[model samples]
Target chain A: SQQGEEDPQALSIQEGENATMNCSYKTSINNLQWYRQNSGRGLVHLILIRSNEREKHSGRLRVTLDTSKKSSSLLITASRAADTASYFCATDPFTDKLIFGTGTRLQVFP
Target chain B: EAGVAQSPRYKIIEKRQSVAFWCNPISGHATLYWYQQILGQGPKLLIQFQNNGVVDDSQLPKDRFSAERLKGVDSTLKIQPAKLEDSAVYLCASSLDIGAVAGANVLTFGAGSRLTVL
Candidate 1:
């Protein structure tokens, strides 16, 4: 079963604009991770944020987690056309298994 | 480092036919997973393995799907008498181990095998 659900099923923006995507989960998690998938391809791990940490940054990507609200958000700064892809948030709820969200399709127009 | 590898990037078969997919995880990785992703949906875990040992397969359709990772290395997923609904992308992923510790269980995924059952 899917534990997380991402908001804004689809979003389109021009190049250089910041894009923010939110994910909500139903239960407590040890960590939350974000992944990117290009059309007809496999998923690529972008970043991971542990429950103990509220936020983390990797290059142009920033991720924030809120265990109390069972939610997390991914921010892409100065988005480029290369950033066009589907983003998904996965949660490991006290288990080795990771449950993925439905994902948000991001389209960055050049 | 070379990433996980998968075979037969795409496949198409008729209902009731059998098909198999192969995966070779990163070197030394002890945990491997197979996930099924339908169109417009998230990838769902079908099974997980830890060094040739079954860790979890609660979601797998045992009647039609079977997977094996012999010798704790390469793995294969097979489906017999496939159904149209079974058509989807099969993703293979691996991790260092099944240790659930934060920041230590990141998974690396392969390019995935797209299956189309008619």
Candidate 2:
């Protein structure tokens, strides 16, 4: 079963714009990680924000975690055509299991 | 380091046919995982292994799906009597370990096996 839900089931934006999505989970988590999947390929880990961390940045990717609300958000700045893919949030709970959220499909047009 | 390897990038079979997918994780990674992803949805955890031992199989459909990691370095997922709903991409991933805390490890995934059942 999915651990959470990702808002904005689909989003379309022009290149150089920014895309943002939110995820909300049910249980307490050790960390929250975001992954990106290109069409017909496996997922690639984007960034991870530990429970104690409120925000983290890697390149154009910025992620924020609010443990109080059990929610996390991923922001991709200056999105490119190659950034078109599905973004999923996976929560690492105390049980050693990583359950992924529904996912947001982002399409960046040139 | 070589990333995770998976075979038969794609497969198509009719309902009730049996099929299998294989995975070889990066060297020395002690944890292996199998996830099923339906189109337009997130990947779902089917099973997880810590070394050669099964750590979790709560979401696996026992009636038709089974997996094994005999040597702890290689793994396989088999589906007998596949159903139409089983059509999805099966992904294999691995991590170094559980770490001092249970769920703190990051996973590296394979290209995935796309299964299409008619």
TM-score result, candidate 1: 0.98
Q: Which model scores highest in lDDT?
A: 1
Top DockQ prediction, candidate number: 2
For candidate 2, chain B by itself scores a TM value of 0.96
What docking tier does model 1 reach? medium
Off by over 4 Å in 2: B100-103
What candidate 1 gets wrong by more than 4 Å, as runs, is: B100-103
lDDT of 2 by residue, A1-110 (tens): 78989999999999999999999999999899999999889999999889999999999999999999999999999999999999999998877778999999999999
TM-score of chain A as modeled in candidate 1? 0.99
For model 2, how does the per-residue alpha-carbon lDDT over B1-118 read when each residue is reduced to its tens digit? 9999998899999999999999999998999999999988899999999999999999999999999999788999999999999999999999989873355878899999999999
